[model samples]
Target: DEMAQIREFIEIAGEYGLAYEYINCALERHPYKISGKAAIKLLEVGLLMGFKSGRENDKRFDRR
Candidate 1:
């Protein structure tokens, strides 16, 4: 299910063109320091793209 969501996100990103390219560049540039603001931005993007947080009634994917 998680993999399917990821694939869907990728497809959405592809449809958005340069948006995903910027995201990929950001990710690549911050491979080791993906915390704080960068992390929040990524999460915001994923949520905006309709990717589930997998936190609802599913502790498996919860942060804590």
Candidate 2:
């Protein structure tokens, strides 16, 4: 079932440091060998951390 979902091409995002934070969090938490909601939380923490970092850097970046 999961494989079936990935066949549709999954996408992820984070703040300015997405790749670094995301991979580090996944590796630190051993997100592999797991599935579903718990896995989502592990990844969510990383993204939120990255978002926080970016937010701290520039509080008004909405001009875009």
Top of the candidates by TM-score: 1
Q: How close is every model to the real structure, measured as TM-score?
A: 0.33, 0.28
The whole-model C-alpha lDDT of candidate 1 against the native structure comes to 0.53
- How many Å off is the CA of 45 in candidate 1? 0.5
In candidate 1, which residue ranges exceed 4 Å CA deviation?
1-31, 52-64
Clashing pairs in 1: none
- At residue 47, give the lDDT of candidate 2: 54
Model 2 misplaced stretches (Cα beyond 4 Å): 1-32, 51-64
All predictions: root-mean-square deviation over Cα? 9.5, 10.7
